[model samples]
Target chain A: MLRIEHFTKTYRSKVAVDDLTLHIAPGEICGFIGHNGAGKTTTLKACCGILQFDKGAITVNGHSILTDPIACKRDLAYIPDNPDLYEFLTGIQYLNFVADIYEVSKTDRNQRIAHYGNLLGMTEDLTLKISECSHGMKQKIALIAALIHKPRLILMDEPFVGLDPIASHQLKNVMAQHCAEGGAILFSTHVLEVAEKLCHKIAIIKGGKLVASGTMEDVRGQASLEQVFLDLEDTL
Target chain B: MIRTLVSLRFRALFTGLIVQRQKKNKSSKGTVILFAFLFLYVFAVVAGMMGFTFYSLAQPYHMLGLDWLYFSMAGLMGLGFAVLGSVFTTQNQLYDAKDNPLLLSMPIPPRIILLSRMIPLLAMNLLFGGLVIVPATVVYAIFVEFSIVGLLLQLLCLAGIAVLAQAISCLLGWLLHLLLSKLNKSLASVLYLVVFLGIYFYVYSQAGEILTAIVMESQQIASILSKWVWPLYAMGMGCLENGGLLLAFLGICAVCFAAVYAILSATFLRSATMSSVSRKRQKLNLKTSKTAPPVNAIVGKELRKFLGSPVYLTNLGVGLLMAAALTVAGVIFREDLLSAFSMIPGFTDLIPLLICAVLSFLISTMYISAPSVSLEGKNIWILKSLPVSGKDILNAKLLFHCRMTVPLCGICGFVLALAYG
Candidate 1:
């Protein structure tokens, strides 16, 4: 569902992500693993049309993110590591705003919001101003908003950071269900065990270069995801 | 450590105002020059008004042998102006500063942090207080009497008045923060703004009459001050070369300031950390959600954001408020205004042109669209990841601005037409 090729982004003189290429087909959950400042965010941002890359191309659902951003953006949703939403908006107001932007029908939005908000245990808090919410609550609100429109692809950065254990488990189920329903997800995470279990494919990046990738079995054969990541870091 | 923190505060203030920290949006030399010119224009306008008002009062007070009253009046005006100008800033800097938690997490004492924060606020008081005192002093010297000792005494009183003003502002700001904690955020902010604007406009509209009364009732004012508020009487006398009274006045100011500083510092810890989440929470049920076209949805979001932020609304939205007020005033005082305009030679025929010019100037005061993009701040990714195009977003913002202003302007124009024509 998402294709990234030769993606290179530089901030002034420093190269953030250099010539990175990766892809996730429909019904696949790709776990993107990397160290801090390893260009995972830059690649993800480029794929979702947030940051314009210095080099290379990324396409979402057969539309180029750079050339036809509107169409590409229509099929995807991105959630950043920090859920810095509009503190002025109530949770439901923010969700309805997202629903409107995606042109979700009133009935469709109502059902999806109820389902996701219930699963994340956020229905009661949805009327509270986002400024009053805890970090985990804000994360749940972000998750519910992202799913309100049912995009073809989802890009998440450190999606499980501020989630409670139960919400995290529910999110795992949600991700699996999304992929099962023919949607794709490219998510970056530090939790190797979660990535090992949840991702159908694995892509390991070190210093903006993909070191190991493919199915979980192909990337971490005879070794755990954590050990392979550490070995790659030490060797590089 | 205090000096370092104070300097960092100033740097932050400067960077936020004049310089764009992002490398991609580095402030150009032209932009800096433009901002400097704008700053100078505002200062010039304020100073010119003070100079004119004080100059008129100087001759009358000198002729009446009420020079102490003149000096005392300046002292009082300086204190009032400084307190009003810096009170809100003091509240924002002391309690609602973004870095309060960050600073508290470090090894610094809360009082020390409070002291450092107040230093910049004190400097602001000095600038505000100086604007009045300096002009009063200049008018006193040129049009009244200029004594060497008197000049030094006025300068000393200037410093003393700034301290008094800063103390009052700190107290008022602390009270305001406490009061605002109990009320809704936007409501409290709007009320604060309305009170401030009401005071400003009332003072401006009645300035001529108030000046006449001050000059006419100098004897009664002098008697009341000496009998009841003798420190102010001492302040006026000291500025006229009375050394003993000057020392007493300065001492009173010092003691009062010390007492206030003690009280503020004692409560700084608790007050600064006061939680603003005192509002009752409401349960969410989206059974009646509605959808709009993509562009209209963006515009709706823009409207919510505009109304949600008091800072944005009060600052740029003043033009809209003024436009509506102008229409009501125009209709209410139509006869008086027309008669006054007719009295001016050849000006009556140009009323429509004049009204249009005034309305245009007011409209130009609002630049909501420009700041709307930058104000997205950290949440900019939400817009970028949305299906909406950049052009669509800009148009939505522009549409929102039009929705706010166009109807009001049209109504203002239609009513004013009946009033003038």
Candidate 2:
């Protein structure tokens, strides 16, 4: 489970993310939606312990992101919008480094790497330096590296931007599977259709404030997710 | 549109410098005062050089006047050129590339982008050149009683020489890059080190001749160079005697500048467009094996990362190679060093161990394994998203640093002990 309360982030005189509160239960997929500069990324980063928030609390599995970041991070995985891995390392080498850090046993690491490598169609690219990989390839490697450790909670910011349709379908399946197996996912995306189709719960933010949060039916009140989004945006 | 773009870029560059200074908690007021002091120091250096030249010229056949002038000019020009090249090649690349992805993706033209970058390069070179050349020429003028025309001609000539030197250095660096890229990446790095060392040694050897001439016969030094050196002579004589050579020198500089600019611009564009290609791997026939030990895994990962990038590997990891070369050279060239050490009653046995420890520390810190986490650029998020604890990640990075440095340190220690014992 993940919880955030009264979170605020300010840069100079501007509030990038105002007081916000939300929660996600285990085995739930929450789609976070907002326009450009709506603070989706900021909130995700804050939750992941990447960026510090001015006032509020965020906890991953009862561990505070700030007070116990290492423990919190140990239970969570975060993938940023752009997947910039060490360009010098081959995909496999990078994975191995991640495995070493997570202390994943040799047997587990090999099994997981092989499973994910095959799923992502990255088995062939594992030997090649990341510098030689294309944008999508880098993203896949990043995704594989993130999931290899199998944390309780996963936080992804703009995770689907560079993925092709086939890759996207596979990722959606994996996300759903993860949720089914009792892990929660919090992802930010502009694609309302994907949010409608995949998210078990959805949260909408406008001007850094949480405008709506609940099950799609609860927030929409008989309207489609798109209509609900447009209506809320119109009211704003 | 171009003008707007250029001005915006220029403003951004200055703004960035200011922002960085602010971030570091440095006052803009302090920077201005520092620059003012630098200018004053430069002026004093130039005045002293000129006075020295005049004193030397006044004593004898006035033949030394030209020699002094040439020596000062070359020294000033060389120093200016070196500062410009170093700032442009290393400092600019290191800082600018930190935020280059954002800038590169913007709508600015490539040439304009290059020009905006070159502004700082030009400013630094011009500042250094003025400090050196102005004083040397002023003193020469006072001693020689140069007419206004002569002074103007000399100024023009110095300008050309400075530009020519800067252009040549930049061109040579570009050409070297192109040549190096044709070879295997690893071999190219080694070749670069060899070339760099070769040039440094050659330049060091010529230092004595240059300095002695400057101190002994300032005017004669200038005059000899003016007479024997085609461009400098043309420039100095034209200044001293109102001749046409100043225009000729300017013309040569202009042509050379244009050619060098064209070559560099083309090369820069090509490099920006070309994707880096990696070596293809052959399939391994070996069976799957168990994972290596924790330390070995960490060390292997770090070594792979270090070796994968030619630039980082050569610059950072080559400390061992450098230490080896230095040790061998010291043994070959300075047998007295070892003998002198042996005379220190209790210190003889400790020297090798001390050397090893120092080298290990230097190597470990210099390569910086922990900072590599931040250097991941965009990929840091992936690492952050893993289920690994921050301590584990930090430990892995630190382990890599120790792994590289400790063994090399041990080897060096062992070798030195064997030799001394």
Candidate 3:
């Protein structure tokens, strides 16, 4: 569902993501594991057409993010780690704004918002101005808005940081349900346990390079995902 | 810690001129100089008006043996100018600052925090006050007397008046904060526009007679000042080497300032942390959900933003207001303007061109689209991540701008055309 081919992004002189390649098929959750400053965000932003890359291409459902951004973006949703959504809008207003952009039918958007908003326990809070919401509430709103259009691919960066344990479990279930419906998710996270338990394929990155990537058993071999991540980090 | 806070506040004020907040590199030397000249130009124009007004008053008051009254008048005008200039800023800095909660959470005392914020405002008051007082002193020296001690005393009195101005502004700003929280912010901006335009038109119409009138009525004005406002009387006298009255005027200013500061300090934390009036809650109903075209949605968003933000509305909407005002003014003075145009050799034939030129000037001031991206600030990601093209977004903003401005211009053009014809 998402293919990042030889993607190299640079900031002035320093390289952010260097000659990296990764692919996530439909019905898969690809956990992109990296430490701080490991170019995880750089790669994620490039894939979502939020950042321009210096080399190579990122494609979503066969549409190039650089050349066919609107088409690529129509098939995917990106929820950044901080959930910096529009504070001037009420939660439902923001959802409707996004829905309007994707041309989501009034009926479909209403049903999806209700379904996701209830699953995240955010139904009562949707009437409040986003500025008045807590960090966790904003995250839930972003999640609901992302799912409102029924995008085929989801690109999330640290999507669980501010969520309560119940919401986090619910989000895990949502991810599983999305993959079960043949939609793929490529998310970056530091929580190895969540990645180990949830991800069908795991890609470990160290210093802008893909250190190991494959099915869970193939990458971890008899060890845990945390050990493999730490071993990769120690070598750097 | 106070020094650090004050420096940060100053940096915040000069961020765009000295260095953009989004950029890491310093502003180019040319950009800095250009900004300096632009600011200086505005300051010079206002100061020049003050200088001229005082110049007109100086010799008349001196000949009438009302030198003390001359100084008192300048002090009063200076106080009014400074208070009006700084009141909105004081309200915003005190009540609406984004970092208030962050700083309030720190270990610093609330009073100290308030002091640091007020110190910059005091500096601004001094600058605004000086725009009037400095020009008055220079005219006074040129036309009346230039005694070294007297000049220094006038300056000292000016400092006291600036403190008084700051106190007045704080009180008024507090009132505005409370009032604005309850009312639509656009109303205050509209009031500001009306007052500004009212003064402008009155002066414009009476350009020849007003200064002469002030000169003619100098005695009555002087008497009113002396009998009703004794502090101003003392301020005037003190400016001319009356050390005792200077001390008295200074004392009154100091007392007023201290009382205001004490009262504000007691409630600084409470007011600073106060959120806007809480809105009544309403749960979302999916049954009532609706959608619009993407372009229309973007324009609706822009409209809401323009209305919600006072700065955005006033600065940009002034053009639309002017266009409306011109249409009304043109209708009212249609016969007079047509006669005036006939007096010009070729102007009658060029009426449409002239009207077009005037309306174009007004419409140019409507900035419905230009600042949209920059105004997004941290929310650029929402647009960047969305399925809409950048071109589509900008086109929507332009469409919104056109909808706001073009119809008004067309109506203005049509009405003036008919009225003139």
| Residue pairs clashing, model 1 | none
Interface DockQ of each model:
0.77, 0.46, 0.73
Please report how far candidate 1 places residue A190 from its true position, in Å: 2.2
- Best of the two (2, 3) by TM-score: 3
lDDT of 3 by residue, B1-421 (tens): 9999999989889884687766567899998999899999999998998998899889988999899988998999899989989999999998888899999999999888888888899899999999999999999997888888988998998899999999999989888888887776777877876797788789878966977877888888888888999999999999988999999999999999999999889988988877674654686787887789999999888887787677888889889988998999999998898888889898898988888889878877887789988998878888999989999999999998999998999998889989986
Candidate 3: misplaced stretches above 4 Å? B200-208, B339-347
lDDT (tens digit, per residue) of candidate 1 on B196-274: 8988899889999999999898899989988998888999999988999999999988888788888988998889899
* Cand. 3 Cα-lDDT: 0.89
Query: lDDT for every model?
Result: 0.89, 0.70, 0.89
Instruction: Give a tens-digit lDDT track for model 1, residues A15-79.
Output: 88888888899999999999999999988888989999889889998999999999998899999
For all the models shown, what interface RMSD does each have? 1.4, 3.6, 1.5
TM-score of each: 0.94, 0.78, 0.95
Q: Per lDDT, what order, best first?
A: 3, 1, 2
Best by lDDT: 3
Candidate 2 positional error at A75, Å: 3.2
Model 3: what TM-score for its first chain?
Answer: 0.98
Enumerate residue pairs that collide in model 3.
none
Whichever of 1 and 2 has more lDDT, that candidate is 1
Question: How well is each residue in B16-80 modelled by candidate 2, as lDDT tens digits?
Answer: 54444324544478775786699688768765754564454333434544443453354445445
